[model samples]
Target: MPDIKKAGNIPTSMLAVASLLLSAPSFAEVYVAPFGGYSFGASEFNIKSSGVGNLASDEEGELKVSESAQYGVMLGFTTTDPGDIYLLYSHQSTELRTGNNFSPSPITDLDLDYLHLGGSLYFPKGDVKPYVTASVGLTSMRPSGEYANETRFSMGFGVGVAYQVAPSFSVFADARGYATFISSDSTLFCNGGDCLWSISSDIMWQGQVNLGLKLTF
Candidate 1:
């Protein structure tokens, strides 16, 4: 029987991705890109809605993930058209902080990862190509301590350019953004017992910029 709990979630492991890439069609042109970059920006999750009550500040405020470094890889093949279809996996190590002040100390540490299957359409002008990319995926949000990990439906979009340095290789960079859907009832990041944050928004958003080398074979 299938686990409904994981219906839209990607496996948190790398093995499934490896197998998919390894089994690509022999005649297809495959693209493997590994990138490193920084991630920033996100709206607040209302703690009041969380029903967790105030921790320190007397004023009402929202909680959010701090800016941090992120890295990931994209593995997929070129389409028949002027586009590339690929699987993207990216990770960011960051912290969750509360209050409007957003102090240096965080409420808890968190690791954020994205697993997506998407495609990009390119505009080729000479060896330099500009493209727009989009992916529909899931996010793995793992917070330290008693908070059990949560997986939610998310999607990403980007615009970037790839300058072909060689016939089979290229260097590229993109500015991308992600949005994760949160249920309206205000339950997220739950342990079998307690849950943290109400996440009142229908969607939580984050943006990133990545640069990497792509090899096509």
Candidate 2:
């Protein structure tokens, strides 16, 4: 397991915000939503020799993650107005294909998951509501086949629109951008005695667009 000491602070902040919202002096409306969407991103992996005297050379590769479907659930609380607080969990499965000089034959499958705490301000106009949201969370990255897994802190913001179809049900669409703060020298993929590569970015960015149904009670 990787040291998640740095990732601990984000959850604390999220909890504080949730507590504040829950303690507000108003009647709160609770809701649950299930959503599905597409996720797309790009990451760079750099490989270097780490042994005693074996042609030391550094090679870099770019992994372009293909657009893939993602799904999640959200639980929320709203006051009398259009402002609400929510907790969300989402999952995405994608493929990482090599770019530049790297071979593109074998694509590595990646599982990405996020747990976020967020708030949104909605502008209600008749039956349509347009909203903006910001969130802080943690993201887990797991690569299948031959790569190490890691968890990192992340933050994001989005804009969305919701349409009320009935008294209790509404349909919504959201587009968000998230950036995970991974350590620059963190190991991304490795093989025993053959190769080892670390991620070369201070942050990795991912974009998502989703459509979902929200039920309020």
Candidate 3:
């Protein structure tokens, strides 16, 4: 397991601040949400190694993470009727296929994970609540090999609606856009002595939609 420090200091600082606010005297409620959904995106990877002498090198390829399963958990604190803060962790299993050829074999399994500190503003209307959320966090990309893994700064924005189903439980659906910023000369997908590719990109984006059950206390 890679250290959280590798993800950088910004996400850590935001989590600490949110934790402090959650412990304040005016905090109204604490809630837990478990969610599962589908995620899709076009995360482009550019080849950077000059000596590989392959057509794939020095060219751009897309990691088409399409319609993959994603799941997560959130721990939240509500301070007022319309305001809350939360920490979230999500895991996504995606298929990495060549951009040009959509083949059945040679499909690589990729894992995309995130940890975020976020806030939400809710509009309460009768028994339903609609909300908008934003977060800053860390994104980790791991391939199913001895590949070079990466952790980068990430941020997201989302909108959702929640319907109260019971006294202390609610069901919700959310859709969010998450992106990670990558630098040039980052190695990826390695094994044994040689790496599959090195990538250079300014940003990698993903779209996620989730259905969840929230429990309040």
Q: Choose the strongest candidate by lDDT.
A: 1
lDDT of 3 at 168: 86
Candidate 3 per-residue C-alpha lDDT over 43-71 given as tens digits, one digit per residue, 9 for 90 to 100: 66655443342434445554445567899
lDDT of 2 by residue, 1-217 (tens): 2244645665665556556656765677778999998887645554333331332345456665677899999888886666888888999888767655556654568888998888999999999999999999899877886656768899989999999999889999999999888777656555554434455668778899999999988
Off by more than 4 A, model 1: 1-27, 49-60, 101-104
lDDT of 1 by residue, 1-217 (tens): 3453555655544455556566666666887899999999976676543443344333345778899999999888876668887888999999988776434368889999998988999999999999999999899889988878889999999999999999889999999999998776466677665555545567789999999999998
Question: Model 2 clash pairs?
Answer: none
User: Candidate 2, which segments miss by more than 4 Å at Cα?
Assistant: 1-26, 43-57, 190-195
Flag the better candidate by TM-score, 2 or 3: 3
Model 3 quality (TM-score): 0.80
Query: Which ranges in model 3 have alpha carbons more than 4 Å from their true place?
Result: 1-22, 48-60, 101-107, 189-194
- lDDT scores of the candidates, listed in order: 0.81, 0.77, 0.77
After the best TM-score superposition of candidate 3, give how far the Cα of residue 91 lies from its true spot, in angstroms: 0.7
Question: Which of the two, 1 or 2, has more lDDT?
Answer: 1
Output the number of the TM-score-best candidate. Answer: 1
